[model samples]
Target chain A: MKFLKLSMSATAFAAAMAASTSAMAEEYKMVILQSLTGGAAFIGKNVADGAAMAADELNANGFFGEGNSLVYEVADDATDRTQTLSLITRLAADEDVLIVMGPTSGSVALAGANVANEREFPVITTTNSMEVIENGPWSFILTQPADVTIPYIADFTAQTLGAKNCAIIGVKDNEAYVALQRKYEDLIQAQGVNLASVDGVALADSDFSALATKIATSEQDCVFIGTPAAQGANLVIQLRQAGLDPSIPILGHNAFASPTFIEKGGAAVENVYLMGAWVPGGYDDFSSAFSTNFEAKTGIPADEWHAVGYSGMQVIANAIKDAVAAGAVTREGVRDALGTQTDIPVVMGEGTYSYDEHRVPHFGMKVLQVKDGAFAVVGE
Target chain B: MLSQQILNGLVTGSVYALFSLGFTLIFGVQKLLNFAHGATFMAGAFIAYYCTISGLPFLLAIGFSMVATGVIAILVDLIAFRSLRKRGNAEFPALVSSIGVDLILVSIAQQVSKTQVLNFPFGTFPVKFYTFMGLRISLLQLVILATVAVLVALLIFYLKKTTFGRQVRAVATNERAAALLGVNAQSVYLQTFFIAGALAGLAGVLIGLLFNSMQFLMGEPYMLRAFVVVVIGGLGSVPGAIVASLMLGVMQSLTVAYLPSGLTDAIIFALLFVVLLIRPNGLFGDANAVAGGTRQ
Candidate 1:
């Protein structure tokens, strides 16, 4: 009886130890790179904050798994391509890191894509460069490519807004802006709109007085601003001040999503139309939840950058959780899981967001108009 | 349209001339390239922006920003160039040092702005327009032209008539000789820096308003354009900088209007290259553009 009782006690203690082991949770960390400084810092900083907000909520609610939590660290790239390259390599080399995300710019992300492939590390980012997709499979992008979105916006401007001729102006040195403008021109011409003159300025150019005069007198029905938010805003303001008829519409792209455009352009941007990757008013349940939670944490209403960042984080966490569920926690396992993710719920895309065989994520967008210092859905 | 474009160019060029004049002024006296001059320009805009948001009147904010930037320019000299100047070999080292200081200032600005572009509150300046001879011009443009003219005239008059001007010219001719002749060389340097910085600051405010946007790196392109203006104007010639700035502005405007798109910088830089090849000393520059400031 004594031996039997002793055996039973040992068995109970063994079972208790096993139960405790199962209850223990492990922490995983992902590294994010953003241009928290330099020219692109406005977007980079917001995206990083959005990702951080998502990670916080996931950790609090234990969304990853029964015993797993997600945490993140953000490193500033300062919008330099070479620095981004170095940061990606360094972050990937860290054995404790689960994944890497972001640089917040498509033009700058071209450098990081090569590193991701070489390191065989998964770099999920909101960088929307199609050329980056060709670089390697390691880079999983969340934002719609400029080629896809710009053309769509151009069609809307030419067709819906009824612009007969649209003049273009932007910094010539920026390949991204140049590419975007070229795409817009192509689409508008395809839609039977006349192509007006394209005005190009060097980067960091302040005064648009001369360009404004040319555009105002050119008789274009509309003008497509192929520049960043700040530059575009200043240009439009100058154009209006230089006697461009306020009746003529102004067209823009993702840069208009930035609050800077409206804030800086003020009365000038009224009635301007632009495409957004995410329309907050479009009403996605997931987006709404993320916005509410993010506002609660950061005290600022989440915008496009925030939505992209949050969506990217959710995708990463879901991939990791899938890898964990399959009992394969390796980097490759996480990457493969991302590849096979089906019908994943996201905040930014329209109508059944999913990845194609080429590893490019496809989503829909909206065209918005500036009304009374706020963005209103164009058709709605 | 052609006349309108010319007017537009002149208006834009006036600001360029205002900005370039300060840059040339520094080279005129100290004979050292203060790349940090751009930082002072950026700072002027920022200071004015903050002052405006703090509820200071527009004109008052402009004055405060001017004073603050002048002081900031002096501080830049103290930190970046003075030590090198004291050591008696200030040229290359000063250039490198000024570039370093420019980076630090830009970095600090980036942090302060959180990388967001700033705009003055609407109605910071009255927006009124005028049309004459089929050329439409805003009241702001008229003000900019008048401001540039008045400031340039005042600068020229001050340099030509003042005792301080004589000292500065004496130092420009020969720092050691000026020091031997009882001209306080250091004081002259500080004064020139202040003047240059004040002009740059004023230019910054005008630009911040004209463009309706301000960013940490806003001064960079102006610096490049101003460098071209300074080089083409003859490195240390104030008059040269003004004429070249206006000419470049008109040419740039014309090119954008008539030429193929995206050819403005190429045309400008090509002109710069041609000028360098043809007149090495520049259109108005003297042979001794460096002056005899290279001393120990």
Candidate 2:
């Protein structure tokens, strides 16, 4: 009889402890949607790492407050647009999910924006295209638009570099690069810069010999490369090998300001200029702190993609913090708070986060140059 | 500009000929297409790349890669084609089996390299240019042309002047008759596959050096072009493959130089379609592949 009484009391105590623990913690979910496999795996993996680090930091620091916890549900879209749409819809419908993080590629992000708008859920994307945000009110873009960055680059080429004849080579298969190339073509031609030649190559093509030969013979003062970092590096190296003047100005998109470019291009990338969103150590304290943490964790210096992803997580984390402060941590609450996020701390650059009516972040890129196999701010 | 483009085309065509010669030689002997030829090509470059990066001399690396890829090709035959041949399966089965092996090889490569585009360290080859008649050529290009020429001559000498070459030709003419005459058919297959793979491996290494990039998927595009080269040259005609390779290379170069960049592929394939329409047997293919003139 004494043993039975003890067991009953212990069961009662266990039940009470469970109830208290449950009441003490409130769970909010942040759904991370991005490509974890397929061709975009490199970018997607970095983005997911950044998001995971952000979540870990927030939970560890009690950023969500004493009685609150943030949970992450990661979904791999596999870099497919249809999969992105379906996953975004499913995440939006989940009652515990407060916000969605990304479908990092431009095409997938654009499709995801449609689902977010329909479900009235908030999404922050790391794609370079502004069209993703323009798709809906619930969308926020982390990277600066190509329209803003590309034109600035063209002007810089004309005004600062004093380039007369500019040659352009774009990867034709990529829609983002094509759009960027078209914009550059128009802007440079309009700026009275003589267009030497406009050429395009397939995405996986490594033999830029044919194109490099053309560019080398054209006598262009500068060459604009609108390909991905890997391909761009190949072009730059092959161009130099094909007997193009090493001192000739070579310019590239934001993607070129990456360790991959430097590592792959080796000595070829020295003096190559890039227009990108982040300049390492040039931004605020948060930028330095983020860089230190990222290098400590990843063992490599952060690139532009890492910056976009890290800043993307900061935007969502800040929104969640604001929602918890306001006593409303629902999806609607997070969405509204994110919409009103003016002066929210981010790691991309110095400016505080402010969103326009379309929720597109008004940010600009600074010019960066690769010197001694590292990215440094131009004119530094 | 045109002269320079043509020179560039010749350099590219030589590499294509080196790759296609192996593919055609295999098809000529067995009347089967080895889709895994491309994967074998890729493996050669990858092996050579690892060897070079691991501090081996470039020449030794090339030799090692060729031998390794040759062994791999023999294994491909043993695994993919041998069982089907024993079962008396049609040609299509061999094609399907080779594709499966190709996927397996490519997957292995992707895993090994982690899908990164690797480059030979700078100074693996010097960057020197020679200009003549207002057209520039690199020392690397000259070396490539010489390598291809020497390799082709060696292959021809091995096929035409050796006892094993006679056995291979006899087997190609009739497997049953060759077997009856005491020719070891299996050995012939092994020898042919080895030779073909070695040539492809060498071509892959050279192309990798030329482009300064090597990846698992790098073989895929070249494989597609190999099909065109072999088909246009007549499936199994070595001399025809060499000639057609040069022509296709010149055509591709001229198109890329003059036409809209997007239309380059379309135009090349269209040229292939026209060739097929005009010569269904390919330029040098046997009109009647069957010996003994169809059953009476």
Candidate 3:
């Protein structure tokens, strides 16, 4: 009778252990997908930072709810499309991650969208291009589209600045610049401002004296520069050297909104207007908090890309919280929660999120001008 | 528009001439197309920039850069090319060996200077405007043109008048015969490379100043253009290289100013193709010379 009683206890203990182990296995796993290495590291590092911070904040605050310990996994895509897809597949199948954030570049994000859609994992792309969300269902962009930023710039330049004629200069053979130039030209024309001329310069060409001279001699009131920081900085210096006054007003695309632009352009970049998704120095709380924490953590200035990255992470964390609250911790459930997200308070400062029509954020941009060698919010 | 384009071409063509003359001289004397020529040019620019940045006077920097490049060229020949000659390798093997040296030198440069464009600290050289009838030219272009002309004239005088230059010409024409006549062909070859490297180095310093940006990879573009100039100008002819450089530069400039930028490179290549079709051995090529044997 004693032996039977002992056997009954042993059986009960084994059953209880099995039940608890099975329950533990059902907990949600999150993956932070990013390009940690390569040419895009400048942007990728920030995105990774933002996601990690959000994860840390969420976990520490018990945002995943009581008794639900979230497991976070980070994967490097190396800014390669093939590797990005491979990483997504591995993370989805092996880790069984319910949600993911980023595959940084717009082009890489587009490729990641297809895999995310197939696996039912919601991926919040941090790139600003509209192409990321045009076809994918499980993808949502955290950055504002060119269409929104371009139109805003047109109105700002025409009405606020009272610019009558503008010259548009874009980098030759770059598809992104080509698309931006087309939108800019259309918007400028729509604003009743004369589109004086459109010039295409090669990326490697340092001699912009000829182009600058032509622009100076033209009837244009302002010049719109659409190139990366390196070429753009060179053009600005050359333009001024060739006797084109900075007082005439120079407007640039979002490409000119990086710290590299300021660092490279130096004093020459002063008084230039840039229309970007986030207003640098405008997000008082976010900027201050990020600067203090980021400098302490990484010993580097948290540029605009870092802000976008942090915002992307916040969005993902919110969706994860909503997913768990609704009792849908699976990939499909997390994706559904992210898809239904509305007005997520991102670090980019209070942006609305809607993937109803497409997986794109319809965030408005703030105009910032380089004043006294630093970006400051102008009359918006 | 056409005239402006031609002027642009002339400037570029002058650069091509400077590059090709060095390449042809090396090929003619050594029978080896020194692929490391580009690296020598790159080294020259780096040395010049380093010297200038370190507070050396501008002229001294140029002189130091040239001398440094010439020394490096001789070292390259001794360490890399000398082994192949000692081993009695075929012409192809010697050429291949030079390419290996080129790879090593280029990699060393790339590692030393991370792959970013270093801007040369060029304040404006005195700017003067010269008007010739309806055409206007800048002082910078005039300086470049005058320098090239003077260098070419000096090169011709040295080759015709100097005993060492005559020995160089003799070795280039017939290495075996020159050596049999106690002309010290090896020394002639070494001196030829030294002079050729100095010219290439000077060109690099000039180009770096002109573009205001110097990178490790900058040499490749000029090297390729030099090859085209050499092919079109006729191999082993310094005068031919100069003439072809001018023509090529004019063609490129015209294409850039008038035609769509996309078509510019295509048009330049098309002109090169036309030249090849008309004169397979090049404009100044010897009538009886075997095709593809000029360098050998």
Order of the predicted models by lDDT, top scorer first: 1, 2, 3
> Which prediction has the highest DockQ against the true structure?
1
- Model 1: lDDT of residue A280: 50
Point out the higher-scoring one by DockQ: 1 or 3: 1
RMSD to true structure for each model, in Å: 4.7, 4.3, 7.9
Q: How many backbone clashes does candidate 3 have?
A: 3
**DockQ per candidate, 2 decimals:** 0.57, 0.46, 0.14
Question: CA lDDT of each candidate?
Answer: 0.81, 0.80, 0.71
> Where is model 3 more than 4 Å wrong at Cα?
A1-129, A132-144, A162-165, A213-219, A243-248, A259-270, A278-285, A288-357, A361-364, A371-376, B1-117, B120-208, B214-228, B234-237, B248-250, B283-296
Model 1 chain B: which ten-residue window has the lowest total lDDT?
A: B287-296
lDDT of 3 by residue, B175-255 (tens): 678788999977976787788888888888877766555666567767777877777877666777888888877766555
Tens digit of per-residue lDDT, candidate 1, span B200-269: 9999999898888888999898888999999999988878898999998899889888899777888999
Off by over 4 Å in 1: A1-23, A65-67, A280-301, A351-353, B289-296
Candidate 2 chain A: worst 10 consecutive residues by lDDT? A36-45
The TM-score obtained by model 2 is 0.85
Please state the CAPRI-style docking class of candidate 2. acceptable
* Per-model tally of clashing residue pairs: 1, 0, 3
